[model samples]
Target chain A: MSFFDRFFGKEKKKSAGVAKDRLMIAIAADRENSRIPNLDQMRAEIISVLEKYISIDEIEISKERKGDMDMLEIEVVVKSTG
Target chain B: MGIVFAVISGKGGVGKTTTSANLAIGTAMEGKKTVVVDFDIGQRNLDMILGLENRVVYDITHIMDGEANLSQALIKDKKNENLYFLAASQTKDKSVLERDKVKHLIDDLKENFDYIFLDSPAGIEGGFEHTIHYADNVIVVVNPEVSSIRDADRVIGLVDAKSHKAKAGETVGKFLLINRIDPELIEKNEMIATDDILDILSVTLLGKVPEDKRVIDASNTGKPVILHKESEAGKAYRRISKRLCGEDVPFEDVENAPSKGIMGKIKGLFK
Candidate 1:
């Protein structure tokens, strides 16, 4: 694109980037597994897995018991700079 | 900048606040200017532990909200002139601890204190994140139990993933302070072993505190056990403090303390 077009186009893209983006992740472990992963470890793993695609701005984690299995629900908001 | 340490645990009642109080006083006793902040928010216990509860006119929220300055809010320790205390707000608003505000407060404290100890809340939610966000080192408090060890492991992971040092691609030194260890229970193979806990957590073992009844009495009186020279738990904390200052102190023989009576001998047989 021309210099003038490129300069003016940046503002439009910046506004679009300001829009919020959210990512929800869930991990579960059942009694069949000898060892269940800790919530913090799973959180780091989730961030590393998502790091290849986007940067994380904030994270929220909670636990839910489902039958015989335990689950970790992670909600991460991607960094706007990405 | 001064070192910022967060005394944290995964579960509640694992002695995180107690450790923070003792360690801060321990460091201050060694001639380092120290300040311990109660980051438990609605559940303020550090003030009581340090026996400075009555002196708290303002809290962390007051300072963060500009209602009070850092010096104005800080309570000087009655015994140790070098030690200071910052009480947590009793307000139910747990969300008052914003990341930037927390960092600003810590940075301001670092300018004046040699060691800043953050007494983190029980869970890894709400105030817990902000408490460890600026930590240069973390003291993971655990008990010789399965649940406590598992929770401490989780906390260790969070320290690596969430701290400012971690975000900046730097490492935050992690150490474990195993507390509330019952020697009799361990001799009976009932409680988890110290070696097993260290192996599971994979963090440097700072020290082990024997489960002493004196700790309870000290807490009840709003005094740190470290002040009681006769208490084993108090002595262990003093040694831990010295170790933190890079002193070469020998670890306590918690595993092999001499048996007391017939029941103790029976417990030893199970070992």
Candidate 2:
């Protein structure tokens, strides 16, 4: 383990002999709205927000409907340098 | 191996199921062995649209669960000799579609048929992902409306991000099928034009289906609209099928089409 990894307690664990860094964010639209927002614009906005924290390698957005509200679930895979 | 196409739309009621049924029947009419699998789960409607509801004994779940073999679950179309259908389970929940099971079933089907059409459920739920995961091609259906176009853009993104072809660093061919277009509405500037939709979705235009009442009538009567030779929608689907088969069929001039009147009716009868 590296000095930074041990001090910060950010331990990288391997599952099935492979390592991965995955981030997921769920954004729900306002229930009062009659329709969902434009997904393309939302995706761009979300990526801008995520860029401040991590270097994203790829992003995937999937739509979902729960009861009357619509949701956009975003998944981001961060770049690994090690 | 066969080409697997997923007829998907992010929004519901935009003619995804209707397009799937007609395309399956159209390709079968071209003498290719085709099978369309419904992935809608509990809200199964593809069989109803194909007029094969009464013929469905075993469904996709039964085959995936090993309770029935492929031959036992496959329902040959009553009208088209080369066409077959595998209905979605009405009793099982959408979660029953595990990734491995879906991949196995689709792989097996690809070995036996020339084309496999997966009728994806509306929205980007589990049912939709399961259908698109194994697709080699994708047909995104949309009506000429703002909401429908936006949702279709979302689906186009998913096809790139979620499909096995996409994950393998291979491109899954994507096409846009615009359905229920009304010429009068277009002239009145009430509906979005085909060019605008194509630009927004940024996919090749496969075909457009006109708003023909015969579509609904065919659905109600348990017949695919493609069987109605005189209907404009039927002709459009036939053109789409030929286009899918690598033919260069030209798009119909929707704006120049004869108005629906006695003269048009007479012309249609002759056609």
Residue-level lDDT tens digits of model 2 in B127-211:
8998889899999998887667767766776686688788799989999999999988765345667776775567999998999
* TM-score per model over all chains: 0.77, 0.74
lDDT of each: 0.81, 0.82
Q: What is residue A30's positional error in candidate 1, in angstroms?
A: 9.9
Report the CAPRI category for model 2.
incorrect
Candidate 2 clash pair list: none
**A-chain TM-score, model 2:** 0.46
Please tell me which predicted candidate would have the highest TM-score against the true structure: 1
Off by over 4 Å in 1: A1-82, B257-271
Per-residue C-alpha lDDT of model 1 across residues B1-271, encoded as one tens digit per residue: 7899988898899999889999999999999999999998998888888888899999999977889999899999888999999999887578788888899999999999999999999979888898788999998999876567666766776676688788799989899999998887776455777776775667999999999999899999988999999999999999999998889999987766565568556544654
Among these predicted structures, which one has the highest lDDT?
2
